[model samples]
Target: MFRALAVAFAVVLIAGATTFLALRPIEQVHSSTPVAAAPLRATTTRPTSPPTTTAPPTTRTTTTTTTTVTANPVSVVENFYAAINERDFATAWALGGRNLGRSYTEFVAGFDGTVRDDLTVTSVTGQTVYVSLIAWQTDGTPRYYSGWYTVSNGEIQHGKLSG
Candidate 1:
């Protein structure tokens, strides 16, 4: 009976060991070095005519550049007033008549003895700007004036004045 029990225990231990060895997981090791591939050679259908080579066709490219100029309404009015303040009659006159129909002499005579003390742009409607200003005559009389000035092409085309 003791020999039979010992044989049975030995058989069970051997079976468990066999099962554990068979079910154990396997680990794979990867190499860190890069492997180079072999270069490919082109094959030709015909070995005759010394393998003639043809050049590709040439292409023509055309480029066009365009420029646009736009005038600012406020700058025109400000520059006109600046020319007037500086007593540059010729420049002031040139800055006029895009919309205003006054002649050069008339424009110059209008600014005579009229010193612009202060100017305030009240509002702007399209190309027209309404302004209120304080001016003085040659006799030193202070006057309040308001007017609408129309500008085009950096010039004063027309103006309406009231005091």
Candidate 2:
């Protein structure tokens, strides 16, 4: 179990480091420009003949609308750690969205079969979507982790966990 935990921690650290390194260059290339909206057109047509009994043709014009998307909840992100610390996999799973909830349950079951009390969340930011944490064993040995949480449509869609 100890070996498995060590390997998991190592993998998380490597993955996080790789993601940070990967995204840094992309961030540098980021650009902000407003896209131009399409123009709208209207047309009027004359009827072929003036008739005693006439029906007008229904004309339809379509317009495109743009909307800003909003994000989801902090407790959704917070609950992952909360559930882990409490060993409440069911609650953690329920806290997440369809896919993430299932993933969290699998992760919990795969990782040590239980979460220790030493897991602590140090800080959370950006809709509580980002978290920094320190998880330790009873002996005070530390495991460091950092991850981002994404929420959509009132549910936690995904998370990227690393150390």
lDDT, residue 35, candidate 1: 58
Worst 10 residues of 2 by lDDT: 42-51
Candidate 1 lDDT at 48 equals: 24
Query: Candidate 1, clashing residue pairs?
Result: 99-157, 99-158, 100-157, 100-158
Alpha-carbon TM-score of each model against the true structure: 0.55, 0.42
**Span of ten consecutive residues with least summed lDDT in model 1:** 42-51
Count of clashes, each model: 4, 0
Give the number of colliding residue pairs in candidate 1.
Answer: 4
Q: On residues 1-163, what C-alpha lDDT tens digit does candidate 2 reach at each position?
A: 5555555556666767666665554323335975554453333333333334434579999999999765445656666667767777676666663455446545665446233533344456555466666666556566777777776665577776687
Q: How big is the positional error of residue 12 in model 2, measured in Å on the Cα after superposition? A: 75
Q: Report how far residue 101 has shifted in candidate 2, in Å.
A: 9.1
lDDT, candidate 1, 1-163, per-residue tens: 5555555556666767666665666444567975564453333232223324434578989999896654677777777778788887677677773346666777677777887656789999999889987887778888888998988766777898799
- In candidate 1, which residue ranges exceed 4 Å CA deviation? 1-62, 97-99
Error of 1 at 89 (Å): 1.0
| Highest TM-score model number | 1
